[model samples]
Target chain A: MKVTILGCYSATPRTFTNPTSQVLEVRNHLFLIDCGEGTQVQLRKYKIKFSRIKHIFISHLHGDHFFGLPGLISTFRLLGRESELHIYGPKGIKEAVTLFLKLGDSWTNYPLIFHELESKDTELLFEDDSVSVSTIPLDHRVYTNGFLFKEKPAPRKLDVKATTKHNIDRSQFNNIKNGANGKTANGVEVANQKLTLDPPNPKSYAFCSDTAYNETILPLIENVDVLYHESTFLESESRLCQKTKHATAKQAAQIAHKAQVGNLILGHYSTRYKSIDLFKEEALEVFPRVALADDGKSFDI
Target chain B: MKVTILGCYSATPRTFTNPTSQVLEVRNHLFLIDCGEGTQVQLRKYKIKFSRIKHIFISHLHGDHFFGLPGLISTFRLLGRESELHIYGPKGIKEAVTLFLKLGDSWTNYPLIFHELESKDTELLFEDDSVSVSTIPLDHRVYTNGFLFKEKPAPRKLDVKATTKHNIDRSQFNNIKNGANGKTANGVEVANQKLTLDPPNPKSYAFCSDTAYNETILPLIENVDVLYHESTFLESESRLCQKTKHATAKQAAQIAHKAQVGNLILGHYSTRYKSIDLFKEEALEVFPRVALADDGKSFDI
Candidate 1:
């Protein structure tokens, strides 16, 4: 799995910074997270294929998070895209987007589906054989939720050397790979453990943004292989963090540490500070495996 | 009066080019027109002061024409703007913008007023003593109207030397500037033209975009000091122009020539064109005084 950061600034777009937006590449699926204003331009700058985005997840209804969605959708239509697009976000998103399309008097040639999220509990939103997604309710000024993407375990691997030594028949190859014992024409029992090995553990990624420090999400994101958390302010602005219901760098690290995430990524820094080294330094105090997220940065999990 | 092109390309925002948007500086107001996607970023790149923009005019509801408005308004709120903002646009614009704000649960501290355009005839949408703006109905895929910003004839210049030679009292300057006959204490009359000369006929500017080749707008924009017209295609692509309800370069210049506009500014080039010089070349065939509008290029009217 690979993740790319298109933008990571708080509040508004600036000359050197942008609002929140990212891309997650997992199991041949490209998922867009929180398309902020200017996101279409950023996608072009990064050379990310526009048609590859089939799923979009919006954390909330803030302009900085989903303002670019309408433009992106319209561009897809202009480009003659025919694939279906699925959008999952809080309630009222469908109405807002529909109003834009209705006012413009232009409709997409492709199928556009919206999955409005209104539940306050963790609920499965998407699932396939290889991966699954669930929402983690977050504490914020408005309806917001963090998304958890978990990869399903792979199929059992065949131990070729062990199978050969055990004299496993060619007809039982499929059964052995499935960790099942198969009988031969001689009526002899073939043990599955002798021909198969355990599958590799799956990885998980969690995206959390525009939320206050809440321990309630720990269970949903616990032990995630990668954790992307918003760090809207530094320590100096800690007081404003609570008032605005935004997370500071230190607070994000505390959540990562408590959740025991493998790696913590901090982003969405405010434009007031020119340097982002302070956020990294503050976050590292709580979680040693913390890294600051920057625009165009890519991470492999 | 000065006009700056923020974006002129038609349809979609590209990596190096932008869609419809412009900044017109008349008197002391910085009027933003037709905010497409990524307009805020373009404004930042051009070093425009967002706060200086007190009014915004949206030509239509097409995504390429006005998708950036909500984001710009949200940014103003985030920046703690306290001044009132006036937006003039077609019907359904107010509800579209209000829906976005309500969904985000974010309200602006500043007063935001929307003047929804519902008239098919030429009507004054915005005006003051120094400048007046009227709508020019155009043929397009949707209900749209172009804007004509005419600078009111400046206060007739008081010819100080002529006034002194005529022995006019300084206290009568106001009456002379207002084109009124000066009444003297001894029942004497002073002709206004003898004391004052007309100020350099106040400049006028007309903006027409996303419209097909139609001569109906000529009368409304006739004899304007400067006219910015959309040329979305070349003569070779004139077929597409008609099919898409857009104008070609030659078509735009034809209107400019027929209307006897002082200067013809051609823009909204299609992305298929490699260079903008072709638009000027094509327009010059019909109108000699034609120039291609480039992003960030400023023109003094």
Candidate 2:
């Protein structure tokens, strides 16, 4: 799995920094998360194929989180796209987007579907044969959610030498890979464990942002391969974090340490700070495996 | 009067080119016309002060014309702007913008006033002591209007030498500048023309875009100092122009010639064209003075 950060600044986009938005590539699906303003231009700058974005997941209704959605959808129509697109966002997303498109008389030519989310509990949002996505309810000024993406376990690998030694026919290889016992021509049974080996562990990623420091999401994001959390301010400005319902670097580290995730990624830095190194330094006090998220940066998990 | 082209291309914004948007500086007011997507970034890139903009005039409801408005308004709030902003656009603008802001719960602290328009006849949209703006109804697929900004004749300039020779009292200078006859100390009447030369011919700028090849607007824009007309296609694609309700380069030139404007500016070129010089060349065939509008290019009238 690979994730690309298109933008990660807080509040409004500026001359050199962008708002919250990212693209995650997992299980052959390219999913867009939290499309902020100027995301389309950033996508062009990063050379991400616009058509590859089949599904979009918005965390909340903040302007910095979803202001770019309407423009992106209009660009798709202008580019003559025909593929169906699915959008998963908050309840009022459809109404807001529909009103804007209706006023402009710019309806899409393709099938556009919206999956409005209103659940306040951890619930499944999307699922396929190889991947599944669920929401992590978060505490904020408005209704918001974090997303958890996990890859499904693959089929067991076949042990060719062991299968051949057991006189298993080639036609029975499919059954062995499916975790079933293989039978020889003589009607002797071969145990499934003897004929195949366990597959590698599946990978998982979690994204949390625009939320206060809360331990309620720890259970849902526990043991994730990579966890991205918003650190809008430093410990020095923790008071602002409390007032705005945003997280500081120290709080984000505490959450990562409690969840025991493999790696922690910090993003959504406030523009007030001249340097981002302070966030990492503050986070390192609690969690050693922490990385900074920067625009146009790519991570491999 | 000075005009700056923020984005002049038709349809969608690309990696290098932007959609329809411009900044006109006339009579101490920085008026933004047709804010397309990514306009805020373009404004920052061109170093246009955000606070200097007090009025925004949208030509139509097309996404390419006004998609960036909501984000721009939200940014103003984030920057702690306290001044009132006036937006002039089609009737549905208020509902559309209000819905988007309401969904995000991001209401602006500044007073936002909207002047919704649905008139089919020429009407004055804005006016003050020094400048006046009127709408030029245009033929298009949607309810659209072009704007004509005219600088009111300045208080007639005082011909200091002539006034002194006429022995006019200093206190009567104000009356002479106001186009009144001046009285000398001996009760001699001095003609207004002799006391003051006619204020430099009031400069005017007409902005017409996203319209078909119609001559109805010529009377409203006639003899203007500078006229900006949309040329979305070349003469070869004139057929497409009729089908799309757009004007060709030749058509724009024809209007300029008939209207007898001081200078003709061509913009809103289709992205399919490889060279914009073709538009200037074709327009120059019908009009002698023609200028091409490019992003970041400025014009002084």
Candidate 3:
């Protein structure tokens, strides 16, 4: 899994910092998350393939999160995109997006499918043979949902030397990979574990932003390989988190600790601070594994 | 008048280039014209004061023209703006902008007034003591209008030497500047022209973009000091102009020539061209004193 942070600042886009937007690549799919203003330009700066993004997930209806969607959709049309685009966002996103398109009289030639999310409960949003995506309901000023991407367990790998010694028929290779027992040439039953080896462990990532310190999400994101949590402030300003519905670095670290994730990625930094190194410093007090997210930065997990 | 080109390229935003957006400074007012996506960042990069922009004129509803508006408005709110903002655009722009704000439940604290236009004829959109802005109807894919910014003829400057020689009292200075006759010390009436000289010829700038070759705007923009016209294509691609509702550099130059504009500024070049110098080269064929508009470039008119 690879995660690219297109923008990680909070509230507004500026000359040097941008608002929230990221790209998560897993199992051959490039999922765009929270497309803030100027995301298209950032995508260009990062040299990401625009055509490869088939699905976009918006956390909320805030301008910093979804303001770029209309422009992006319009650009796709201008570039003559033929594949359908799927948008998963808040309930009111459809009206907000379609209204502008209608006003401009510039409807897309390609299909635009909006998956409006209003559910307060954790719900499965997408699933395929290799991967699955679901919502992690978050507590924010508005209705918001962070996404959880998890790769499905792969089929068992064949122990070629063990299989050959067992005289397993080549036709039974498929069955063996499916954890089925294979018969030897002497008609003796062989255990499935004797012919097959365990496959590599699956990877997972959870993205949460614009949320307060809420522990209810722990169960939903438990043991994820990487967790990107919003750290809009440090412990010094933890007092402001409640009113703003944002999380401080220490709060995010506490949540990550409770969830027992492999590592925690901190992002959505407020521009008020002089340095983001302070955020990492504050988060380290609660969580041992902490990484800071900056614009144009990428991580491999 | 100083005009800053934030992003003059056509179609979509990209790395190292932008879409349609400009800052026109006239009569101490910083007016934002056609705020395409990424305009706020461009404004910051170009060091234009965001708070000074009280008025924004959107030429059309096309994404390339006005997609950045909502994000900008949101930024104003986040920055705790107290001054009112005025937006002049198409009839449906109000609905399109308000819908997204409503979706996010993020209403501006400052008053946001919209002057929705659906006129096919020239009409004044804003007027003050020093400057007046009006709409110059243009033919484009949608209902569109370019803006005309004119410095209302300033009070004739006092010829200090002549005024003192005519013994014009300081109390009569206002009257003298207003073109009234000044009384001489010997009680002789002095000609107004002798006491006051005409103020620097009123500076005028006409911005016409995203339009086809249309002659209807000639009367509205005739004799303007500067004409910034869209030259989306070159003569080589003039064949595409008819269907795209855009103009070639030659077409823009022809309009500039017929209108007798002081100078023609060509912008909104399609990204298909390798160099914008070709646009200037093509326009100079039909008209002299032509300048090319580039992102981050400024023109003093």
Pick the TM-score winner: 3
Give a tens-digit lDDT track for model 1, residues B1-301: 9999989998888877889999999988899999998899889999899899999999999999999999999989988999999999999999999999998889888999999998889899888989888899888899888999988878777888976666677788887787887755565787877777767788889999989998999889999989999999999988897678999999999999999999999998888988889999989989989988988889999
Could you give the candidate ranking by TM-score, starting with the highest? 3, 2, 1
User: Residue B43 of candidate 2: its Cα lDDT?
Assistant: 92
Docking quality tier of model 2: medium
- Per-residue lDDT tens digits of candidate 3, residues A117-200? 999999898899988999999999999999999999988899999988988899999988888999998999999988988878
lDDT of 3 by residue, B1-301 (tens): 9999999999899988999999999988999999999999999898888899999999999999999999999999998999999999999999999998998899999999999999898899999999999999999999999999999888888899987777778888888888889997678888888988878888999999989999988998999999999999999999999999999999999999999999999999999989999999999999998999999999998
lDDT tens readout by residue for model 2, A1-301:
8999999999887778899999999978999999998899899999999899999999999889998899899888989999989999999999988888888788999989999999999889899999999999988888899999999998889999998899999999887888889999899998999998878889999999889998999999999999999999998999897678999999999999999999999999999999998999999999999999999999998
Q: Name the weakest run of 10 consecutive residues (lDDT summed) in model 3 chain B.
A: B163-172
DockQ of each: 0.81, 0.68, 0.89
Give stretches of model 3 more than 4 Å off: A169-171, B167-175
Error of 1 at B4 (Å): 0.7
Candidate achieving higher TM-score, 1 or 2: 2
Give me the candidate number with maximum DockQ.
3
Residue by residue across A1-301, what tens digits does model 1's lDDT show? 7889999988888777878999999897898999998888899999999999999999999999999999999999999999999999999999999889989888889999999999999999899999898998988889999899999998888888876776667878887786788565577776777677887788899999989999999999999999999898988898987788999999999999999999999998988887999999999998999888998899998
Native-contact fraction for each model? 0.90, 0.60, 0.92
Model 2 Cα lDDT, one tens digit per residue, B81-122: 999999999999999898889888889999999999999998
- lDDT of prediction 1: 0.90
